[model samples]
Target: MLTATLCALLLVNLWTILRFREDKRRAVAGARRIPEADLLALALIGGTPGAFFARHRFRHKTRKQPFSTWLWLIAAIQAGALIGFGWPR
Candidate 1:
């Protein structure tokens, strides 16, 4: 079950990254602000890869803002959890 959940989460993260890429492209073309909230939702749902991808791909928010800091912190925690909990029995 955990494995399945992890797989699903990873897929979701990848999807989120793709979506973020689209949003960023649109932004460069003069679209409105990328819906970073969606990225936050993805991160909260164990999609740190998406968050990391967004940070680098879109250059979305690497500043000293609260949202950016919190997102990165959460992503780190999620990664640590996965590493700690994903080892073989």
Candidate 2:
């Protein structure tokens, strides 16, 4: 169980990082953007850390109203849940 969880975390983080880099590329190339919902969904599913880092490192979506707010909110919730669920019995 722990192995699976850890694997998911790494994979999700990698995905988030790649997504951010791709988004930046498309933005500079004047191409279609990846959907915001897709990005948010990734964050909700254990990708929040990567998403947060990518946002700052790529300088994307930081100043966007409510988006940053939501990311932070999701991160906090995920952190709480992790603590709650992983608490020693």
Candidate 3:
């Protein structure tokens, strides 16, 4: 079960990465940019790792504006939740 769950997480991580790439491309092309709320939702839905990588890889959401800060904040919260509550019972 652990192995299966690891595999599933790996697949989800990869999918999130691909989605981030696509979303970044669209943001670059549309010239309007994606919103932070959407990004936060993705991160909350197990996409935080991908979002962090995307911010660095694509140089996206790296600004000091509220959007970037908020996303980072969300990422931090997610990390806290994982570390604080994800242990086995």
Candidate 4:
């Protein structure tokens, strides 16, 4: 069960990175973009690491106002939860 959960998280993070890449591509092309809510939702669900990585790698949404604030908040909450509960057995 633990292995399965870890695998799922890996997949989700990969997906989040892909989404960030796609969003960056669209931004450069001036095309329709991925919604901030969707990106934040991905980070909220154990993709915070991926989100931060993609933000640095793609230089996407780094300085965005509320988005950056919200992403940091999500990371803080996730960190708090991990600290409170400890690692899975």
Candidate 5:
């Protein structure tokens, strides 16, 4: 079960990274872009790490208002939950 869960998380993170990359590409091309809510939703799940990774790697949304705040909030909440609940054995 743990292995399966980890695998699923890995895939989600990868998808999240791809989404960020696509969004960046669209931004540069002045094309339709992925909604911010969708990106936040991804982070709200287990994609926080990937979100940050992609943000730094692609330099995307680094200074976006409210979005940066929301991302940090999500990361903080996730960290708190992990600390409170303890790790899965």
Candidate 6:
């Protein structure tokens, strides 16, 4: 179970990072963009660490209002869950 979880996290992190890079490129070139929902879904699925880093690294979607709001909201929920349920006794 732990190994599977770690593998999922690693893959999602790489996926999120690539999405960030792609989205940034699209923004620069005026191409079709990845959806915000997709990015948020990636974060919610344990790729948040990567998403957080990508946000800063690419400077994409950092200052947006509701999107950033949702990202932080998801992060808060994840943290809360970890603390409340997953923390060691």
TM-score of each: 0.69, 0.88, 0.69, 0.96, 0.96, 0.93
Better of 1 and 5 by lDDT: 5
Each prediction's Cα lDDT score?
0.77, 0.88, 0.73, 0.96, 0.96, 0.93
Model 1 ranges off by over 4 Å: 76-89
What 10-residue stretch in candidate 6 is worst by lDDT? 80-89
Candidate 6: segments with Cα more than 4 A from true spot: none
Off by over 4 Å in 5: none
> Residue-pair clashes per candidate, as listed?
0, 0, 0, 0, 0, 0
Ten contiguous residues minimizing lDDT sum, candidate 3: 31-40
- How far residue 89's Cα lies from its native spot in candidate 5, in Å, is 6.3
As a TM-score, model 3 comes out at 0.69
* TM-score of predicted structure 2: 0.88
RMSD of 1: 2.8
lDDT comparison, 1 vs 3, better candidate: 1
lDDT of 6: 0.93
lDDT of 4: 0.96
After the best TM-score superposition of candidate 4, give how far the Cα of residue 9 lies from its true spot, in angstroms: 0.4
Clashing residue pairs found in predicted model 2: none
Show where candidate 3 strays beyond 4 Å: 31-35, 86-89
**What would the per-residue lDDT of candidate 5 be over residues 18-40, giving only the tens digit for each residue?**
99999999999999999999999
Error in Å for residue 85 of model 2: 2.4
How much lDDT does candidate 3 score? 0.73
lDDT of 6 by residue, 1-89 (tens): 97998898999999999999999999999999999999999999988999999999999999988999999999999999999996655
Model 4 collision count: 0
